[model samples]
Target: MALAVCVLFDARTERRIRELWARLESRGVHTLATHTHGRHHPHLSYAVLREWDLEAVHQAVDRLPDGGPFTLTCQGTLAFPRGRAALAPSLTAELARRQESVVAAVRATGADLHRNYAEGAWVPHVSLATRAPGALLPVVVAAVADVLPMPLVVNRAALVDSGTGETVVLPRIP
Candidate 1:
């Protein structure tokens, strides 16, 4: 499996992600998460783990000079050629620095870095879909149509560890 160091946004921010999904889905953009299969949560991540150094990441995060909350905007929908599908935009400077600090921490552990998703191609977003939701595409489109340009306030960030590879909440940082 791949190891990734990711930051889970606080709940208030998560709600905006869901709202965007709903708005986009309502507008005919097929979503990644549907009622039956998609369980991936709404959050921004630094990188998808090719190799993860949990301890190092935690340490790096601890060392990162605190970057307070910053607002990020979601413009539209996009599909990653790498098999992900969702809505997101470039992260704010604060978010990017925080993400980089985590990466730096992971690198300190001597684990091979797989990918740096925080770079230019990294679009900070709340993913609404990934893996085919099959026949529910149309339904998804109808659910999120109106809220395309929702401005979400990111109040906090967290280092979420995999809980048996299931979505789990961990301690958050300000």
Candidate 2:
């Protein structure tokens, strides 16, 4: 439904998150692993754009300085309206700056930024369950708690289309 500039986790980190997803899925909780499209990657987004020019947005982001890879510690789970649940990561100054830079670059391309991703409103998180009902909160919480304070290794970046699950891999983490 939107295009997101996201930082993807390394294989190790991805596997760990996937394991949690599997556990939740087995318990009848709908996680990203089997969410709509069923082709989601384990990632944390810098920004989600309601509209954008793919190539222009890509070029703009590519022009920015590389922030390189970094690690994020997810200490707890965050539940949002409409049954969305995610791992809330501790924000580092570098991560904030990188996100700001990406937002600016994409906005420069005339992309409409999703309000949730606006500068002052952003909340950095790696999504887990896409539609976890209130009845499944305990399951989601317990699954996440089992992996609390997880060290997430971010090694790549990309522009992913939420509707089609298509990705345009970025040259660097910006």
Candidate 3:
């Protein structure tokens, strides 16, 4: 149905993101132990496609020219497309370069990618939460506020399915 491409953080790095999320959870500000098939995880989303062929998406990302090796600093929070809660980061050239490449490469698959993200919606974030419980957004934001300006490194990106458990690692072009 739909597919999303994201940057998978290293185990150690992801742990920190999880730790921050856990802190938010403790404050009763974010969802934990998700019931949905898609369990929550920390990630920087690159793009989403309307019509996705997982294999093609992988190939597209795989072929993307690498220009990463950047750090994104989270400055605030944002809600989008739906109830998705996200941490907004100050844009970095490398992040934008890699993101743009993924969008363009995926479009070559002939899928109509969301223009909002392709043109201007790329926020360059390390997800704080997604599909948030309407009640917890404010708390989550406040919890994260104490830790605002968390910086995440972007070294590699991947092609993944949001619903099904699937991921394809694309080598960084650096």
Candidate 4:
């Protein structure tokens, strides 16, 4: 199980993502919509912890200054190794700095950060398919292209349990 500091999408963006998930599912592709625990919310994670003291991680993140709402324009599709597919968001300096800050704060709590989430190494993405095979890249790409240049409004931040989808909603977008 992992815990992540995530920035959640606004209602319209969330609904659009969910609709995309349904479309992907109808095409025989697996998505977060029906992944593991089946309660995933549409989000982009700042830092994912492989190991952490829940309360400590939460407190560490909660202490960060509120970054407030921002927008991420997903302009392309990303097919990572191991059949993972996602939407590649056009990053801004503000997004990068916010992610770095969150990573640093979580690390300060002695949390074991997922290597992929390490500051400069991080690629901001909104996951679409969890196990799409290479043969299916075109399908994933086509579906994502339909939503290209999609602007995702990030209006909330929370500490989410990856396994169970349990969330500890933070007061501000941090």
Candidates, ranked, lDDT: 2, 4, 3, 1
List ranges where model 1 is wrong by over 4 Å.
19-39, 116-121, 132-145, 162-174
Question: Once model 4 is optimally superposed onto the true structure by TM-score, how far is the C-alpha of residue 102 displaced, in angstroms?
Answer: 0.2
How many backbone collisions does model 3 have?
1
Q: What is the TM-score of each candidate against the true structure?
A: 0.67, 0.98, 0.82, 0.98
Runs of candidate 3 with Cα error greater than 4 angstroms are 30-35, 131-135
- Cα displacement (Å) at residue 19, model 2: 0.7
lDDT (C-alpha, whole model) for all candidates: 0.56, 0.93, 0.69, 0.93
Query: What TM value does model 2 have?
Result: 0.98
Residue 110's C-alpha lDDT in candidate 4?
Answer: 98
Write the residue-wise lDDT of candidate 2 on 136-169 in tens digits.
Answer: 9888989899888899999999999999999988
Better of 3 and 4 by lDDT: 4
Q: Candidate 3, TM-score vs. the true structure?
A: 0.82
lDDT of 3 by residue, 125-156 (tens): 66666556778778777876887777777666
Q: Which stretches of candidate 4 lie over 4 Å from their true place?
A: none
> How well does candidate 4 score on lDDT at residue 21?
93
Q: Is candidate 1 or 3 superior in TM-score?
A: 3
